[model samples]
Structure formats: structure tokens, C-alpha cells
Target: MARSPKDVSAHFSDVAEVYHDLRTTDQEPIISIKNQLGHLLYKPSINAADIGCGNGRYSLLLPQHLGDRLRLTFADKNRCMLNMLTKRLDHTCSSEVIQSSAECIPVCEKSFDFATAFNAVHHFKLKDFLAEMARILKDGGLLFIYTRTQEQNRCNIWGKYFPDFCKKETRLWKERDFCRVVAQTSQFALQDSVYFTYRRVSSLERLIEQAEGHHYSTFWLYSDKSFREALDRFQQNITAQFTDPAKIQWTDENTLFVLKKIREAR
Candidate 1:
């Protein structure tokens, strides 16, 4: 089951102290964000916001990639996440941290040149967050959303082997619906969409550790007893399918959607 807003916020807060250790970067978003930003016409300064920036997984390394011209704001609902992110940052880049939710960002209208959400949208109320983005982004500002769609989620190794993993993560967006929602808002125009597939190699023991640690929020949705049963089955399935417990391989896929603010929100 999808967790409520309060539960999700609490879940992140509970894990904030060890977020960097528990969460896998899945895909390095800095490369993708930097490449997309590079294609744009050069701007003297880029005011960017990393919404739902949990522990600064993606935004922390962005300053080095884009240089001093990148002004960043890290926003998330959990104060603990922002605090953890603060320790990781060296204060070399011009940045700000805001305690705010994705659905209601507290910032001046049309304030940002760009906004990016990586692996964070599934926790948001999609339309409300889109509306907030439309309100806060300047005309021509870009929005980069990197997430796993329902189809792409099914391709994950856990989805294939972990019992009911896919069925429990019902909050993911469908690709068609995702594009349609952006277009229907009229404040943004879809620019491009692409799929990024990464080959993952991990030992069975490591996978179990991550699962037991509840590295992903999806695991939090499972009851303790249910998760225990599933973990046992997941381990057995992996051992039976793979020739070597230490050399299991699979592909994980995620999508990136690029949209541009077409007009000012009324």
C-alpha cells in the first residue's frame, strides 16, 4: 500500500541519519542533469531547485559538474533530511535549504530557472506538485523528472523475484498519464522523454542486507511479518535462478521527462 503523506514524511525523518548509507543512488543524476542543462543556451546564472532533495543525493555533486554559475536550493518536507544534507555539503557552492513539501513550495512566483525531481515524484500528489512547479518556475524554465514508471518498475530485479514487490508499489505513474498530465496543465510543454537502463551486479548477501535495512521506501509499505516472509522467498528464488550467488545480474530502467514552462500560471 502507498503510505500517507504523514507516514512518508515520518519514514524519511526516521531514516535521515543513515539515508546516504541506506539509499542507493540507483542512477547518477548529475550526469543527466548536467548534459540536459548544457544543451540550453548559455545563461549567466542558473537558479535551480532540487525538490524532494533527500540527503542531497543528486544535487550535492551538481556544483562541481556545472561550476559556480549554478545556484541551488534543496527543498524537502523532512527537516532531518535537510540537516543530513547540510553536513554532506562543504559550503563551496551557493545554495539554500528549505523545509517544504513538493505539493506546496514556499517561494516567490517564477523564481527558479530550473527545477529537477529525481526519484522523488512517486511520493507526491502528482497534480498538486505540477501546479506548484508551474507557479514557481519562470517562463522557459525547465523541469527534469527522473523516475521509474509503472512499466519500468516491473523490470527491476526485485519486481521479478521479490514476491508482491511490484503489486505493492502502486504509486508509480504510467508513462502515457505522465505525459498527458504535463500537457493538460497548459503551463508546461513536454520537451523530451528518455529511458535510462543500468546494468546492476550484486551479491545475494548484499541484496538481502539492503532489503532488510529497508533501503527503499517500498519495503516500508510491507508489514514486518510480510516482509520477513517475502525476504525468505526472495533469497531462495535468487539462489535457484542465478548460477552464482555473488554474480547475480539484472537491468534496472528509469525514465526522464523534460518539460519547459510555456506560460505563467495565473
Candidate 2:
């Protein structure tokens, strides 16, 4: 059965702590986004929001690149996830944590200078979320989406061991499909699309631990019997394929889309 949007949010709420513990902000993508934003002039106050900002991983990193003037809003539907972010960020003046879904952001339209959704778009009704983003962003405001396409997910190491992982995550958009969706929005123009690749080296034991902890939402969709069977197969594959678990490397690929809101005519 396909999980509804509410079910997806609930799953994240259930594993909020574990997800935060296992996830880290990828610095490479951060640098890529920072470079793209370099051409824009910095303002005394920059209004930014991170939709589905899980545990404030990316939010915490924004101040460095966006400067101290960044007033960030971290929005997520799961209260547990928002609570985690609040605790980690300590409710500073520079940041506000809001419990809201991406489909209907609670902010005023054209109020933000920048917006981002990091690996969170798949959880949303993409069309509504994109339109909401366009409405909320100031004219020329940038929206950055950092997510894995279905193709990228299929190429990951998890897909090799757990075939169902890719199959079950059919909600992920392909790159071309994503481009088409942006075109359909008509409120935003695609500025740039880039793929960032990184090598993730981990022990088979640790990888198994992450899977058991449901580090990725896809793992939450697995039935107990299926998860156990897949884990066993994954273990066997690792044992047969690699002599040393420490030497095992997985390729992590992420696609970033930089879109800018079109200015309204007076």
C-alpha cells in the first residue's frame, strides 16, 4: 500500500531522533549552493526558509555562507522533528522553527529572499509545493532543491542489496520529469541544475545498523519479514564481495536544482 502524505510525516516523527543522529549535512552541496548565490548582493537582513528542514542540519550551516544577517525559518510537519531542531538551535534570534507542511507554508507570500528543500520534495505533493514556494519567494528569490532522482537512487549501493528500495520509492522524480514540472509551474525559471557526487565509505556492520534504524524513509516502508530477508541477503552479498568491510565504498549522488521566481509585471 502506498503511504499517504500524513503517513509519511508520521513515519518521520516516529524515527525523528534516529534520523537526526544518522544524517549529516553534505558540505559539498552546501558549497555548490553558496557559489551559485555569490552573484547576489548580501542584504542587512536575509529572510530564508528551509522546507522540511530535518533536525536543522542544513539550517545550522546556512549562517556561515549567508552571513549573520540570515533570519531562518525551519518548517516541518512533524512536531518531533521540529522539536529536535528547536533544541539543537536553541531558539536563537536568527532562527524560527515552524511546524508546517510544505504544501501549505504558513508564511506570507513574497516574504522570503531564499528557500530550500533538501531531500524533502519527494515527501510533498510536488506541484502544490512548488507553487507555494514560488508564491512565498520574493521576485528573483532563489529556491534550491537538493534531492536524489529515481535514477540516482537506483545507482546507490542500497539499491544493489535491497532491490525493493528503489522499486518502492517511485515517488522520486527523474531529472527530466523534474525539469518538466518546473516548466509547468511558469512562476519560476530554471537557473541551474547540477549533480554532486560523493564517495561514502562505511563498514557493512554500520550500514546494517543504519538500515535497522530506518535512517532513510524508504526503510520505514519495508515489512518486517521483507526487511529481515533483505538484510540477510545484503550481509551475504557484502561477505562474498568484499574481504574488508572498511574498504567498501558507496557512491552518493544528489541533484540540485536552482530556480528563481519570475518578477511580476507592474
lDDT of 2 at 167: 80
After superposition, the stretches of candidate 1 with alpha carbons farther than 4 Å from their true spots are: 1-9, 26-28, 38-41, 264-266
Model 1, 1-266: lDDT tens digits are 34442244467777788778865675456677777775452887888999999899888777877788888999998888898998998888899899999999889998998899988998898889989999899888889998999899888889999999889888889899888888788788888887788898989988988887677788887877788899999999999999999989999898889888897546
lDDT (10s digit) by residue, model 2, range 1-266? 44443245467777778776676458777777778775453567888899999788776788777677778888988888887787788544487778988989888999898898898888889899988998899998999999999999987878776647888778889999999999998899999988888888888878888888778888766676777888888888887878898777878889999999999889
* TM-score of candidate 2 to 2 decimals: 0.93
Best by TM-score: 2
List the global CA lDDT of all models: 0.85, 0.82
Give the residue spans of candidate 2 off by over 4 A.
1-9, 39-41, 90-93
Worst 10 residues of 1 by lDDT: 1-10
What lDDT is obtained when candidate 1 is compared to the true structure?
0.85
Against the correct fold, how does model 1 do in TM-score? 0.93
User: How many angstroms is residue 4 displaced in model 1 relative to the true structure, after the best TM-score fit?
Assistant: 12
lDDT of 1 at 88: 91
